[model samples]
Target: MARVLFVVFGGLAYLIFFATFLYLIAFVGDLPGVPRTVDHGPAGDRITAFIVDLGLIGLFGLQHTIMARQGFKRGWTAIVPKPVERSVYVLFASIALLILFAFWRPIPQPVWAVENPLAVSVIWGLFALGWLIVLSSTFLINHFELFGLKQVYQNLRGAAPSPPRFRQPFFYRLVRHPLYAGFIIAFWATPEMTLGHLLFSVGMTIYILIAIPYEERDLVGALGDDYASYRGRVGMLFPRLRRASPSTPPLEARDS
Candidate 1:
């Protein structure tokens, strides 16, 4: 049946996307076997390599931003089944990442490299923790839903998807965008900072900063005053040392 096919396709897309994401961690960390890293690649003209690398990153950022916008989703769902749209987006994003990994040019020069073994070990531990935070946050906020598996499964069962609800789980209570925070920590926690790694970090951090306002605007539109209140009290990407006022309602009960 068409519904069954959608579920299967969505599941496959999610698997590929998740695998690619795991591979990205290895690629960035220069674990082993990869052809390119922040400092591992064929030598070439620096200017040309920089331009091409930026182009690839820009392409990925553009696709991610555009596809996530409300206007684009509205238009896209008009053509494609609503349940499968997220899967399609995931597929496209995975392909974009694959292209980036395949063609990325590395600037082999080191900006900074920590020589102390203890410090190196600490940084590596932080890097792993950052990735752990990212993965855990997804589950706290409905990993299956985020990955499109929940949507297609519900559709196949002939059930309408539930409305989006506002939630602030453990890490979310600390920071408004803990996932992005995790990414920031992961990208910068390296014991060795090569020019290519710096480029990738700077580019992604810029994208995160730019993307947050748009994402917040959409959240406000969906969650209204609740999100506004939360925004006023919570730090955008960092945790506030002060406790919230007693007058503010508990986050769990405040679903739109």
Candidate 2:
């Protein structure tokens, strides 16, 4: 019952978030580069800042909605079961309100500026490619839905099964957490090349670092020795060239 309610609410939230994003992009059109310190011009400058900041907030909200939906559909027994944590969601909410307030008033808004069009283009291209990777991985994972008749049967018994095997062939082979990697890539790809934007990204990166370790520990506990072995084979967030097999024997066999 709780799961059902969560999914319903999450779906609605996601729809609202997307609606805001589309409305802004359609109304505001392409964003223009602005100074990093302050937007000291006319009313249009303030409008632009409001639009862009709102768009970012919408994006974050959408992320939260998806994560919540995933948690409801799957099991939330693990810590940080979704893409973003509860604290992170609250943080985004607070930031969104602050930004909206700032934009509403006649505050000194240092607009994020993007210089070097080529670099911006390259970063955007990479971001698009990263999203493709993410989409492909999602598809391969059966839209993150559970798989197999056995798994479905188990779910009916109120037992959530392990993550599907498709994860390995698609994104898991490259990194332990491909979704996070994709997010990092996309965030970095933004054309806001100002110091403030860079600092914000850095702060977010630090949050990711703290969140990843907590997530990993939860996975390790839930997945047990097998997850530990997988961790040994794969890097936490980055891709690395690995040999086919490790020299160590299986942990299960050793236990037996």
Candidate 3:
């Protein structure tokens, strides 16, 4: 059946996405055996490297941002089956990431390297924790859905996927975009900050910043007043110390 085939395809795409994500962790951290890391490639022309690296990142960002918009989704699903649209998105994203990791030109110059053992350990720990937060946050929301597995599975089962809901559970309460926060923490908490690492961090950080407004716009449109109210009460990428006034109405109820 087409439905079963779609589910299988989605599952395969998820496997690739998961592997690529793990490889990204190792790539950023410069773990063993990864051919290219944030700071582990041979020296090359600075200008050429800069342009190439930026192009790679820009391509990824362009694909990611464009595909995420509601307008694009509306048009895309007109041609592609709605159930597999997400899988296609995931596949392309994974390919983009793979291209970045494969051809990235590392600058290899140290911007900062901690000499203190204690500080080094702490920073490394924070890097790991940042990744943990990113992974955990997906589950706190819907890991399967976020990764495209749930959509195809539900379709195969003849069930309509549920609408997006406004939620502020766990890290969501701390920041409207905890995944981005986690990425920021992971990118910057490195004990050794190479020029290449810095480029990747700064570039991605810029993308994250640019992405928030657009993403929030989409969220406001999808979730309406509920998201607008939550936005007022929560920080975009950091936690608020104090809760909103008790007079503020509670967020609209929906399944978490």
Candidate 2, 112-220: lDDT as tens digits: 5557889777866876765666556555445424112333333445665555231355577667777667656654566544433443345446556756766666666
Tens digit of per-residue lDDT, candidate 1, span 1-256: 9999999999999999998989888877877787766567677788878998899889988998999888999999999899999999999999999888888888877999999999999999999998999999899888999889999999999999978778888887778899999888998899989888899899988989999999899999888877888897798888999888888875554322
Q: Write the per-residue lDDT of candidate 3 for residues 45-69, one digit (tens) a residue.
A: 8888888899989988998999999
Query: Best candidate per TM-score, number?
Result: 3
Model 3: lDDT of residue 158: 99
Error of 1 at 207 (Å): 0.4
Which ten contiguous residues of candidate 2 have the minimum total lDDT? 34-43
- Position 128, candidate 1: lDDT: 96
Residue 104's lDDT in candidate 1: 84
| Whole-model alpha-carbon lDDT for candidate 1 | 0.88
- Model 2 — TM-score against the truth? 0.53
lDDT of 3: 0.90
